[model samples]
Target: MIKTSFISKTVSELKPSGIRRFFDLAANMEGVISLGVGEPDFVTSWSVREAAILSLEQGHTSYTANAGLLELRREIADYMHKSFEVTYNPADEIIVTVGASQAIDIALRATVSPGEEVLIVEPSFVSYAPLVMLAGGIAKTIQTANENEFKLMPQQLEEAITPNTKAIMLCSPNNPTGTQLGKEDLIKLSQIVKKHDLLVISDEIYSELAYDESYTSMAAIEEMRERTIVINGFSKGFAMTGWRLGFVCAPADIASAMLKIHQYTMMCASTMAQYAALEALKNGGSDVEEMRSSYRRRRNYIVKSFNEIGLDCHTPGGAFYAFPSIRLTGLSSEEFAEKLLMEEKVAVVPGNVFGDSGEGHIRCSYATSMDQLQEAVKRIGRFIEKYKVE
Candidate 1:
């Protein structure tokens, strides 16, 4: 008798996240220093936690409105206007979701039709392509290079667009690379976006973690507000990863469509998480600054150390990761990462897992403690000494 295949072709074809592979490997091994996962070493601020506790105590345990608490939506609108200079009506233009991941998911499901193409800029967050495919949209990639600091160029964006293209996904203060596009860079890309009349899904979860320069939202660009959906959350900047809260801001029509899908699937975000996020928006600025400062310090140390040890890492303008070229070792990225994990017990993600252009490099997250980072660097230096090609 033949056995039935239960999984859908889409789910079966999806590749596992490369970041988690090394993380799981390091988990089983003792004495491993993992720089693999892109999570904060800091705990969620006490006030945020207290708010959640207080809400539970006050019997705010019931489900919130499908779009989330009206109060929270108002707070999000205020925060977005204040931080990014982008404005959205709280009533119909914002929807709080389970996390930024869900915000991206519903946005794709709402906007993309079968066979529609979404241009994904790489090295991108791993979820974007898979989410597009799962939504019955084709994921097309525009590979960015280290030569240009891994930023998406306007020319490249224009060249990648076709008649079937429906939208583009962007992540600034990007995962894996930590690259942030400036206002001028965004203006250039915005011109291309308008020329092609495509929608943009901008992930700004790391907006507050910017180091070298102020963060700019793509929706803040002239005339782009109507065409962009902003995805942000309390995960990175507020050290609230465990809270699992995020939100989306878009035009009323698009937001309504996203809300319809979210209502059926997620129902509502956690009421307690929503209350905690309210406290975060109202009073978590100082905590965010402290964590940002710590990440900035770690960024400086890790990049300098990587370069000093001959790894040739670029100074990431934002986020807590350093993408360094491991080409000197003359090994594939997977080879280098696997061998390093096995030999030195140091876990860093291989670059090729991000995209084709990411080969010959590795992404080391500086979200770990300073002492662990120092020790990991030493171990990596030793591994490099052993593997470096003459």
Candidate 2:
């Protein structure tokens, strides 16, 4: 019999993902409408899939450069330049990763030393803190509130830094909240990063999903090119989540470090997926726009419906989520979500799972079809009315 103590203390101490708890509950039941997962419902565009099929047929099964295929890397570089106005050398300054998630993992491992601290702006992605800990760095979660639309302000950034602080993880078009940091906000943050000499890991996975305003890359800010590590992928924007394709773009020194980790740990992303992503970068623009338009409409409808039902959802600026405060019902976020699932057969993630500041809220994804979303919202409304306090 294996002893539990043989497992790494770090691995044993990590909390299981909260998002999966509701997902697991819903999976066992019938007639459940789930808005819990963050993945896009859209299937990979046909052209991209076709490219992968073609690659497999050609027997290009062997690995390319450890950094990734030069041709695909060149296409990625071009796309970054055209889309965000940030240029990275395909040869030495970019690495193709398994997903944006792995890009984040390797980037943290490369830069953060043991006992150093990485400031995570929350309520953000669940993976950031765990990844930092896995890399032997301390995770410091800086909670941001709804009043500021969940955007991390300059003052907050200044207040959170300490001598042990080595880096900051930022998510624009944030996962649970769907709020984004604008150009002016990025400039303010860049100034702070400069003063504190902190590395910035900018997760721009949702960059193409912004609605009202164009998304800005932190790496595009003046002098930020050297300091910012931009993490992105085809998962959200291109609906290629299952393809498991993502990349990290950084300055040569940092990129080299991350590439070393990738070479040993991942040994290059899947060859077929890289080819698929190349096709996405080349010909998937229209498909991306089509899906983005659908998510926009769904976002508008879902946000409006939540507010009308007394849920008080802040209109998401980007991404396919609507985060609604569930405090008015006087139910804790977990209680509300669990009851809603049991009684109404509707599944949404408890907001508190994102962070403590998210305690009174719940995250509702609008990525499902309009019909499913419509049904989920109706069920949620009925639950809210039934549980209304006073």
Candidate 3:
């Protein structure tokens, strides 16, 4: 009999996702209004789903090129250039991935050698640090604060870098905090990255959902294109989360390295999903705008609701999340989340679960219906009013 202890130490030591734990609890309880999950509640548009159905009917169910269908890659390349002003050669510079999640994983695995350090900007997505560790690298963090709208500062980036640092994991319209990086900030940060000779795994999955200003890609910066690996997918922008399709666009050499790792592990992203994504890239702009506009309205409503309720939430520039300070309740982020769930039947993620910088905050997703958002806010307001010590 093999011992269970034979599991890799790194895998064994990894903590279960805090997001999943709360989501699971919410799933079991009846009538719980959940604002915990990051996925959009909207179903994939009928047209996109219909494309996948047509593909299946046409017997298009087989493996794609290890780098994904050339047509899809070409569409992705075209989209990046037209939309974000970032260009990539579809032939050798793009590789379709299982999800943006896997793109992040393989990018880290391909670049980081054992004992190398990857600087993560914290109050970040839960997966970044774990993926770095899985890649045999050390996860060093620079915590971003509210004063900076949770955007990573150049000084923080500079101070956090060391001789051992090889790369930085950056997410814009960030998870946990929906704040994004502006062009000026990216220009400053790119200078530091170039000076230090660092790689960037840029996650821009939320780019299309941005409000007011259009989202900026670090890859769009001059000279940063080769240094940046851009990861995006249909999930967020096109309301296709269940489709599980994503891609990584990078320099030819880096893309080749990532593709080598991906071929052995993922082979290629889903064929049906690939076809659907191709359809999406070709014609899904209207659907994306429809959803993004809805999210923006919800964002405006919820940001105001939280402030009115005394939570001090920062109005997010993009994404479907609102990070609100729960400090007045005199409870830790976890305590506030737990009590809110148990008492008010509203589920949200504890900010501390994201990182120490998230200690006094809680993340409320606005992806659900406006009715649900309204009710959740009402319950939260009542709960805070009744229990908050201040």
Give a tens-digit lDDT track for model 2, residues 21-61: 99999999999999988989989999999999999999989
Tens digits of per-residue lDDT for model 3 on 1-390?
Answer: 989698999998898899898898889899999999889998998889999999999999899999999999999999999999988999999999999999999999999999999999989899999999999999999999987789898999999999999999898889989998888989999999999999999999999989979778999999999999999988999888989998999999999999999989988889999999998999999988999999999999999999998888888889999999999989998889999999999999999889999999999999999999999999999999987885
> Per-residue lDDT tens digits of candidate 1, residues 26-98?
9999999999978899989999999999999999999999999999999999999999999999999999999
Model 3, position 379: C-alpha lDDT score: 95
What is the C-alpha local distance difference test score of candidate 3?
Answer: 0.93
Where in model 3 is the C-alpha error above 4 Å? none
Give lDDT: candidate 3, residue 130.
Answer: 93
Compute the lDDT for candidate 1: 0.94
Task: Compare the candidates by lDDT and give the number of the best one.
Answer: 1
- RMSD each, Å: 1.0, 0.8, 1.0
Ranking by lDDT: 1, 2, 3
lDDT of 3 at 340: 90
